[model samples]
Target: MKADRIVSVIFILIALVFWSQTFGLQYNCSIFPHLILIFLILSSAIMFAQTFFAKDIKREHLSGKDLKYIIISIAIVFVWIYMLDFLGFIVSSVICLSILTLILDQKRPMPVRTLSSVAIYTLMVLVFWFIFHKFLLVPLPTGYLI
Candidate 1:
């Protein structure tokens, strides 16, 4: 079995499991998990299709720096998820976005980086505030400061 095929199979299996679990959960309760399930399934389908249908299967070697970036990205996301509730979405997200942008855009101008981080964080906060507070009527997370 080729590496790409193996990864594709694993993704398909995981997607199936997530899809099943989504159905097993109580209906009309939490929509977030369901949306995540759909995303997983869709992504898996794309991966599987790409692996099977694409003619080229030549594996490209990941440079050390590329691997480091990938690992850091995953770590940042994990930390963001863990800190979201405790730190509140705004603070946790701002930190995550700032750090990620800095890591990914090291060569960019300082002003550009700062403005981009502030804009991204502000947009995320506004979106979450609008969706949770206004649309869904769910209470926004109030951190220790609040």
Candidate 2:
């Protein structure tokens, strides 16, 4: 099997296991995860099947630098989740989103670019905060200090 086929098959297995695990959740909580997992399973099956028919198709691969940056971004998101309760949603999200935006932009005039990205994401986070807390009636984490 080609590398792409192997990866697709692995992900299909993973999605099956993940979808199955959602069955243990309460009915209300399980519904969203079920939808997402089913989507993943279907997409993976399509990819795996395409691998056999699309041998002539060119496959795109990420450069080592891009792969490294992608891995680092994933780590940052996991860390952001772990720290959310301790640092609070607003503060931790600001930091993480700012960093992610800057990483993706990487333009000239370093200070200006950094500041613009930070400002934009901060505003975005604030809008989400208002929507979730005010309209949706969901309470967000407020850290000990904040």
Best by lDDT: 2
For every candidate in turn, the CA RMSD to the true structure comes to 3.7, 3.7
Candidate 1 local lDDT, 1-146, one digit each (tens): 25666786777688677667776667775477777767876776677677767787567799999999999999999998888778887778778888888888758659866887779787887798889878989987767542
Per-residue alpha-carbon lDDT of candidate 2 for residues 47-128, written as tens digits (9 for 90 to 100)? 8888778756675789998998999899989988987889888889999988777676656438887888788887998899
Task: Supply the global lDDT for candidate 1.
Answer: 0.78
Q: RMSD in Å for candidate 1, one decimal?
A: 3.7
